[model samples]
Target: MMRQFTNQQDLVHAGISYYTTCCLNLKSLYDNRIELKTMFISKEWEDNMWSKNEAGRRFYNLVVSNEFWDGVLYAINSFEPVVDVLRRMGCGRSSMGNIYGELANVKREIAFRFENKEEHYLPVWYHIDCIKDEHMKTPLHLAGYYLNPLFYYQNGNEIEKTEIFRDALLECAHKMYPDQSVQERIVHQLKLYRTASQSFGRARATLMNFDPVSWWELHGSTAKELSTMALRILRLTCGSLAYEQSWIEMVHKKKPSLVQCNKFEESTFVMVNRRIQEKAQMKDRSCTCIPSQ
Candidate 1:
């Protein structure tokens, strides 16, 4: 029998976060599919279902079978890691520094999950690997990871141990600087940053929000060159979620029927600017209202 599911329209319109959450919840259900299948195949359920219609009984039988349940579980497991990365990337404030490492972890996890069943998972692994090689495997990502204090400090030893990572980071610097002398200066600044970062006890604190851009702004004066590099890297958004959000808002503000054909672009620009101003004002007001300890 078909069951009515509520809020499907809302879920579809809600954006990436909501959709990912729904997928995560569905994954949990798929994890328990075996038990659910047993319940569906029970004598009472079989009697109730069969009493309804021939088609319903046949469908129920197919769903409760081992082959169908296995396929469902496999699909869920295969897509879970991808959904996780997408969820993070689709956030407003996702860290660019974390994307490279996160994708690598996803690749490793997928491999581990399908180690013995290579024939079944090889396609999935190959696709994910191709994405990693094409987009994620870049000097910019390596440099971002190296300069981000959170990853650099936490995964320093691991990063340093990896020859490819070291080479990529240096390669990024060389390309960016171009001049040998400037490259040497950049390297020196990176060393200085490492020293200063190590001595900053506050970096280890968990309560403080770790914003790489803000961190560089506050403490990066000592290593001027590296701070510039850090700021540039940190400013890069991990995904297009913010732009998508703005476009959605603009579309809502200028509904298709009501939008002027000639003035559409102008209207969208005005709407986006207004929204940005509103957000800025709200932030300023909140900051002013906070009482000092």
Candidate 2:
């Protein structure tokens, strides 16, 4: 029946998002919503044997319900920000420097999308906050955000006055370079960076480079120690697995028994491994069978 409106083969299939395909499924269903409603109400459906049955009538009721469609719309809007963050992390590259900023942006995006309605965005924010508070917001992440030239240069001296940034830098400095002398030197270099002095003040440094680690490499020679710190912090992984695991744990909290938790973990593991194997097999086949010139 659905194929009559649009070929099922042409609709979105399972390879769009990482691990879970819920977002892709939601997107596909939402895209075909009008077609679905029209099909349910068409004379063809009325003449069908199943349409007169109790189960079919109930299914039809759901398809035409305003409340059901409203809920789907709300889910799409709420889930999109989280999915975007996941997509950014899954880009097969280092995203340590951007995760903190990205999470902040997620909250802001959700709020803005719902026109600042607390009731609408609060539940989503609460779950995100739980993940962030427990796994993210470490001194390392904060240091990365502070050192990344992408964010640092935008806020300018304003970040210098921010206690959280100052504290995070100090914490990372002490942790990474325990020696008092080295810590003092890092602090001194931080001042130079803040004031845009030395190598940091070079005309070349003023150019807008989006890669934070690369920016430090190119323009941070004068403060070699701070540059090294930036490279280490910025090169770290944002841990896409951590986000996925945290979400799973959050769901487990709402359910009962270790059996359910184990089942969920097993299913997720199988799904991800299957996809990985499929990609690997495809790569091998392509390598073995060269295209004709």
Candidate 3:
């Protein structure tokens, strides 16, 4: 009996599982193509199968085509970067500060792969550019990068310190601290932070567990105004997966089959708050477990 293929959704769900299965399936086909060809072309099988089935002959032709394998490799290479980023972003501990840099690196890798032959990646490049224009490369993202001490200290020289980025950081500071006098204080504190951070060496033992919010809370006393701004920006959520997860879990738990729309919204709001508190507690626990260097 043959199983009927309905749609793409029936083939794979739209998540990490889908990408994992796709990679596995492509690898299997590429690896077993020789064995499959031998079976298909063998005298007994050919007599019984190829002679009786048009689909089998068509598939054998496809298997022998160089273009088919090229397309498979191209798809795997293109989707691998996207899948890596998606896995990282879906983690519970993922931070907004890290996403912008990672996305930039992925774009660079994709460009490098198709260098000098831009036509090969024109479609992919367009999608990457669209993501940058729509979401990843915004002012808020720059602020996240600016406030992350680890990234700022290590990659500051690499990142283009454009006037726009500086202005965006200052604007973020103003929004967080609306008082004109406080804003001036924040500007001064930021200057002091820049000077001190340059001389401060990060310890290797604590580097992996470093949290910008906790760093500000500890060393931020010297630069209280700037620290507040850092904390605010660093705490911002970079991706929507967690929020979406919360809504999905809420729907599953509530089983709101016949509930009114207004009640559903109210329940979802409460669930979101609970989910946020749980995440905060988890973060605090993880922070405590990190040994002080």
Candidate 4:
């Protein structure tokens, strides 16, 4: 029946059971709405015994319903941006530098999709805000947001002036540094960073197009203490999938050890370093291949 209405014999399948796949499936169904409605009313459907059954009738009703289509459209519009965030979190590249900014922007993107109508967008915003408060209200998130070169330089001095960011930075600094003298040095170096001193004040530094971790490597040396903190924060991955993958790979190659765990720890560190080196090499190749305008 579907084949009579459309060139393809079946609905599009995303092939996986993830939430993102569900969204994709819904989008596909919506894209095939015309084909589906035609299939429901065609003689082939009426003559088919299965289509006469109560279950088949219910499915046919759903396919032709205006309310159902409206809901599907709304769900796609709302959840698409969220799927984008999930993809970034799952990708091999470090999302830590941008995840914080992405989360903040996702809310705006959803609202804009709905034309900023409060009646259409406020409920979605409430749920997104709840998720942010419950799971993402961490010092690490704030520190990453503040350290990202794109965000940091774009917001000017306002990032440092923000109270929540200020508190999060202080918390992260003290927690990571431990020593009071080191904390003081970090604070002092932060001022130099804010004022755009030395290498940080360079014309290229002001461009705000560079990768946060790479920018730190190039210009952050002048602010040694703050640079150390920025590099550590910006290099983090947003999800635990990579860690779990590393553990699975480790177990496949080596026997479990309860007594000699230091050896396992060393192996994990080596694997992590190898992954970082591989990503860096890929980034360098990608950069070299881009033609200069």
The 10-residue segment with the lowest total lDDT in model 2 = 284-293
| Cα RMSD to the true fold for all candidates | 8.7, 7.3, 8.2, 6.8
Superposition TM-score, candidate 1 onto the true structure: 0.59
Instruction: For model 1, give the RMSD to the true fold.
Output: 8.7
> For candidate 3, lDDT tens digit of each residue in 1-293?
01121221132222333444465466556555555556556676666645478887787688777798888777765666655565545334456676776666676676676663677766886887787667665667887877777766666666545665677788877777778999899888777665554323333234457677777776677677777778877787653344255455657566657667787777778876775565455444333321221
Q: The CA-based lDDT of model 3 is what? A: 0.62
Evaluated against the true structure, the overall lDDT of model 4 is 0.74
> How accurate locally, in lDDT, is each candidate?
0.63, 0.73, 0.62, 0.74
Better structure of 1 and 3 per lDDT: 1
Q: TM-score for all predictions? A: 0.59, 0.76, 0.66, 0.76
Per candidate, the number of residue pairs that clash is 0, 0, 0, 0
Q: What's the CA error at residue 190 for candidate 4, in Å?
A: 2.0
Task: Report residue 140 deviation for candidate 2 (angstroms).
Answer: 1.2
Worst 10 residues of 1 by lDDT: 4-13
Deviation (Å) of 266 in candidate 4: 17
Task: Please give the range of 10 consecutive residues that has the lowest summed lDDT in model 3.
Answer: 1-10
